[model samples]
Target chain A: MFITSAYAAADTAAKLGEEAVKKKNVFPPFDPSTFTSQLLWLAITFGIFYFLMARVVLPRIGNILEVRRDRISQDLEEAQRLKEETDASIAAYEQELAEARKNAHTIAREASETAKLAADKERQKTEAKLANTLAQAEQTVRKVKDAALAQIDTIASDTTQAIISRLIGTKVTKAELAKAISKIAK
Target chain B: MATHPDPIKQFAINKLLPLDINGVDLSFTNSSLFMVATVVLTSAYFLWSTGGRGMVPTRSQSVSEIVYEFVAGMLRDSAGSSGMKFFPFVFSLFMFILIINMFGMFPYFLTVTAHIIITIALAMAVFLTVLVVGFGRHGVGFLKLFVPSGVPMLIMPLVIAIEIISFIARPISHSVRLFANMLAGHITLKVFAGFIVSLSAMGTVGIVGSILPFAMTVGMTALEFLVAFLQAYVFTMLTCMYINDALHPGGH
Candidate 1:
């Protein structure tokens, strides 16, 4: 009964001071009787709290923070490595492209040079053959003319003999006729 | 007519479980219940918030994280990173006091910090830690904190005496500052509320008059909410400063 009805005694004990120390009030906070329990619970609660903070909760938070930081750094490093690789590959590709273009240009030039040289050689060969064939034809024409001239001389000598015989009833010399025809033909 | 309400009545403690051992009043008081409740609630919040323990934090997790960082930053700024060893003590103190202060604001709930015994116990803990760490780390050189570097030899004794007094008074002031603030703030709020009740009982004009006190009471309650956080912060900050002094004696 005395234990359950403690607050009933609190007010009077608070106002009266030391006279009511035996029937102490808890409101004053300095109540020596209640100090024991308050201090006891405070110690217990704070002890558990300290343990939780020092061991469990704080370390968890720290771990989360540290993990996040490490993950972010790793991501950044991966990104950097990827970027560098991309840049290097691009450079290599560009170099290869330039080399390929150069190679193509040189091949085209060599092909064109070869084609021009071949064309010039073919034209020269054809020109030389045509000149040789034209010279041979000219020589044949000259030979034929000479033979025709000789024949003309012979014909003249015979005509001369016949005319002479018909007009004057006298024949000319064959040698003299032949000589005149040859001079005329020349 | 009902007599004037005792503002102090709200602070009264009752024996919930009558326990005594070796003449000690170990009965479970209301104060013990709230203190236990504070512990339970704080622990539950942390455990529940971080239960998922996901990389991306939830709301309560964020809150807990922010509180941790906030205390860490305070300790780092005031006491340097070396002072981080005391992080648990300061953080627990801050959270315990903060929860108790917030709980006290609830209707019909008692503010535990309003008690000198509790505040003094906390202050003494800080004070004792400072002494132990200071002497342990700095040895006899720790006493140099009481004697400033630049003081003339003539006024050195005076200054030392004053420093010693202040040093001794650290726990007293620290404890009293919080206790008095909560005690007075709550008392003033009760007094204003009392005015409103008494005024409203006197009919129309009195009821109209009662509105002023009613409004003031609302405003004061809001202020008390702010004070609750502010006092907790101040206490934690002071603890950091004291710890800092221990770590670097005579540096200040």
Candidate 2:
């Protein structure tokens, strides 16, 4: 069944080829009759396409590429600028931090030095006051010692006179007693 | 045998619209229809795909850009920055041929490039453009293209003659290369396919035999697709090289 049908189709195709060759002896592509039309339409279609590409399509694509490139470069530049700004701010912050640290150290050292100086002055004042009080106490002690020493000498002389008077059997005249006491005392 | 398919019938030009101007037979043939389709599809694809004009391209847009850059780079590499003036022309030709060739791959679709006239028309345009640009840029010095330097004085005449003939032959070879490739590829494919049909008409043994031709047909189809793209590339590459010669004239 398939063989018969295939033969029939092939027969029809051969008849068609014969008819085609009869109608135009030249090959379809080589036929001059179709040349004018093919050339005409090729010109028309290709011309329109070239115009669109040159004027509209290519320029549009070119613009897109240019804009994208510009955008990328711009973004990169902005990022770079921001980075530099950040770096500057960081540097300034560090500098200020260092200055503040230095000031803090100076103030601490000055405060300690002032405190030490004041303490030294106060100590000197206290020491001088103590020394003056000791000096006055010593002068008072020397005067009291001199007065006791004079009293001791007077007591010793009175005892000596009483003893001499008591030893005597009778009471002699005052002038003669005084002259003997004086001799014995000498 | 009478029971065989005619491969040549596929190339027949059917009149879609009968048109005339000043008694010219400018009827819109199947070849013309495919050309129009090629233009429309290419233009619409580029226009629509690039409508968004996004910084990051869509998939279709990427294809468009890739094609654009591919042609641009080809021209630039061959002709240098000075040759970039021909970018639009080269781009159009490449896209037109590439798309038209792809259109031909569809079953029942007419292959426009298979016709010698159309390929000739394209090649002539490039030839004429090169002539005009070469002469316009360098004047009569453009003829220097035919005289290679450092030729032995004794053989210089022969060398120049050869160069002139080869230079003149450029368009013919360029156009015929594409035309013959498309014509021969499609015809060969049809012939192989016809073998399968005729072979399968036999009994069970014949049907199994048909499998070989069928597989061969499949392989040929894939090869035809590659040839379609490769021919377009080759045509455009030759155009670039010709334009490069025109622009330099002194030989790079």
Candidate 3:
């Protein structure tokens, strides 16, 4: 605003003076040097930031990072150790399990074998007992059948002799009647 | 030459807002939009990818699986088997940033990870997590992280102090590295674009500005694409490393 007003006043003054007046620009406007300033600031900013990071911050982070790395590896080693211990216990338990399984199989086999042997022995004993009872019953039935057959024969002979005596109305020889009866019966 | 007067100008989407507060004008910049885009796109992609998964992987499913396995492999490399615990966080960070950069190739969607504040915040989160987890696991022994084993008495104090400062500055450098690269690239692109306009306005004689920025733009774009990927990986990789610190304080 001041420059414009001064220039207007100068124009008026120039007409008054009638002599020519020089016009000068006290300040130059554009500076290409600002690019250089910009480059300078960029470099400085980068340098300062880099120093703070590489020299100061990065190392601290590196420390924590290193710690983190170290911690992980150590934990892994510890885990491996625990894992080994667990594996050892598992191996021992598995071995015991195997042994127990073997024992169980053996016991089961023996029990089954014993049971079969007992069954076989019982079957043989039963078979022998049945055979003995069959023999005893057969002997008793044969003796009773023989006694009844003798009684039946004796009764038939007496009836025949009595009937023959009634028909003739007289007594006959016992020996002769016996002889005749034997021949007829045959 | 056949394209617009300035392609780099196209890189920045100007959505002027009417809000101002504390003389600190806050507007939804392309960067902010891209950040939101990155998040939304990531969620959408994952959701869509795994939406219809069966025993066999479809194409999207395969892509999702590949990403999962890739991040898983990185976690295992940096954090060991137990590092599986941090799979979700590391994977999310990688995918989120990756998507942001990739999507930024579109006319819209700013590369949010390109911003210093965002990157710094991410790095700071990792730094804080490492600190908390380290101390929480090992307690005072964590301080010994700075004091190395078998250090001589004379320089121990100085070494410890330096170590502390360096530790504190990790997040700043990590974040700035990503932030500065993105910002510098964008700014340079913008400036070169200004040249293209001026040279063209100078009639047929001024067409020379086209050749240089064009070459630079292609080269920078290629480099930026790579940077986008590298930064995300770097961030996630660093995060995995930090989580590893938590898992194994002494590398057991």
**Candidate 1 deviant stretches above 4 angstroms:** A1-33, A120-186, B20-23, B146-163
Q: TM-score: which is higher, 2 or 3?
A: 2
When summed lDDT is taken over every stretch of 10 residues in candidate 1 chain B, the lowest stretch is B1-10
Q: Per-residue lDDT of B151-232 in model 2, one digit per residue for the tens? A: 8899999999999999999999999999999999999999999999898889788899999989999999999999999999
lDDT, each prediction: 0.90, 0.92, 0.64
Q: Write the per-residue lDDT of candidate 1 for residues B44-98, one digit (tens) a residue.
A: 8987887777788888889988999999999999999999999999999999999
- The CA lDDT at A57 in model 1 is 85
How does model 1 fare in lDDT?
0.90
- Model-by-model DockQ, in order: 0.46, 0.61, 0.01
Question: How well is each residue in A1-186 modelled by candidate 2, as lDDT tens digits?
Answer: 899999999999998899777766678878877899999999999999999999999999989988998999999999999999999999999999999999999999999999999999999999999999999999899999998876764565566567767997455555665566568779
Candidate 3 per-residue lDDT over residues B32-68, each given as its tens digit: 4555555555555655665554344578756766676
List model 3 lDDT by residue over A69-146, tens digit each. 687899999999999999999999999999999999999999999999999999999989998998888888888888
